[model samples]
Target chain A: AQSVAQPEDQVNVAEGNPLTVKCTYSVSGNPYLFWYVQYPNRGLQFLLKYITGDNLVKGSYGFEAEFNKSQTSFHLKKPSALVSDSALYFCAAEPRTGANNLFFGTGTRLTVIP
Target chain B: SAVISQKPSRDICQRGTSLTIQCQVDSQVTMMFWYRQQPGQSLTLIATANQGSEATYESGFVIDKFPISRPNLTFSTLTVSNMSPEDSSIYLCSGAGGPSYEQYFGPGTRLTVT
Candidate 1:
């Protein structure tokens, strides 16, 4: 079984300050990890993914996530947070081989204070 | 990445009614999936919509409650049957395949069962 865990239910960051949403994975093997953002009354928007090479993965909306294998973590980060960045964030993972359906985390609500 | 679109962006239905949400992809995709998100919660995978075959449902989901159809590679539908207040949620459709392994999600259909 594969799963992802988001330790924080909510994260607050001031605008122009750095933000981080933590996530950890428990998979049998190397997993494909993903980040998604959802605003109120809207669907999820793909942020970034970590598949194979490069521990640092850059994604849309000036966001990035570092894939730390030793820590079994993929933490989403932004150098400067914006009020527009406030949304619900989800971390997901799937086995690299079979069953491409992603197992999602419980989600973390990010609030960027203006 | 494929562009995905969904119909009936939001709707309100009475108990015991059924709602069918449509999903269309701009390009061909190997995989399509249905997911549900309750208010202030994370996403949960409903099933994998296989093109030309029955959908593979996740552990707490059943085919009778959420029948899915993928007649081709570019389109799919998920029908929420016999709805109640507990059925109120945002239903999302996603597709994966193309050059990227990451999945693209539609804007989603918000269903409110009264």
Candidate 2:
């Protein structure tokens, strides 16, 4: 079955420091990878995606993800972290050739210490 | 990208009662999906609804239990039938279209069954 994994269940970073949320995928073929963030008591917000272009994909809210095919990883990253950036992050992937169904990871909760 | 909205952002229902959540997209989309997120868990796709066709349900989900209606391109509804405490979750709707392969989600409907 196709799936994505977030090794870390929770990540803590000091404000103004760089933050990284790791993700890796296991799929049959080239897959479409995406990142989403959900705030408490709110819905999900699309962060970014890597379809078929540059490996490094930029997305909303100053968030970006590096798609490494060799390692089968698409890690979400930010140059600097803010208290507002603390949320639950999810990594998802879909097979490029089949239906547009997405498989999501178990999510990582990021906390930015002020 | 298309903007999506869902009605009844949160609801509390008694066991054995049902709730219908509506998802509306600002623009037409090719595919719309229904997903369930249990507390502190990842998303699990319930079904995929396309305009002019019966919804394709994923494994472990049956049409009779969770009926879906895709009346048009811009709107869809998911009805959770005979709800139970186990059905208490956040039901999310997502639309996949546009040039990018990424999907956009609505503010989700939180269902609490007691």
lDDT of 2 by residue, B1-114 (tens): 889999889999999998999999999998899999999999999999878788999999999999999999999999999999999999999998833477889989999999
- Count of clashing pairs, candidate 2: 0
Runs off by more than 4 Å, candidate 1: B98-100
Deviation of model 2 at B94, angstroms = 0.9
Ten-residue region with minimum lDDT total, candidate 2 chain A: A93-102
- Model 2 gets an lDDT of 0.92
- In candidate 2, which residue pairs clash? none
Best by TM-score: 2
Candidate 2 regions exceeding 4 Å error are B98-100
Candidate DockQ values, in order, are 0.60, 0.65
Q: Estimate each model's TM-score.
A: 0.94, 0.96
Clashes of 1: 0
The alpha-carbon lDDT assigned to residue A18 of candidate 1 equals: 98
| Candidate 1: tens digits of C-alpha lDDT, residues B46-92 | 99999899999999999999999999999999999999999999999
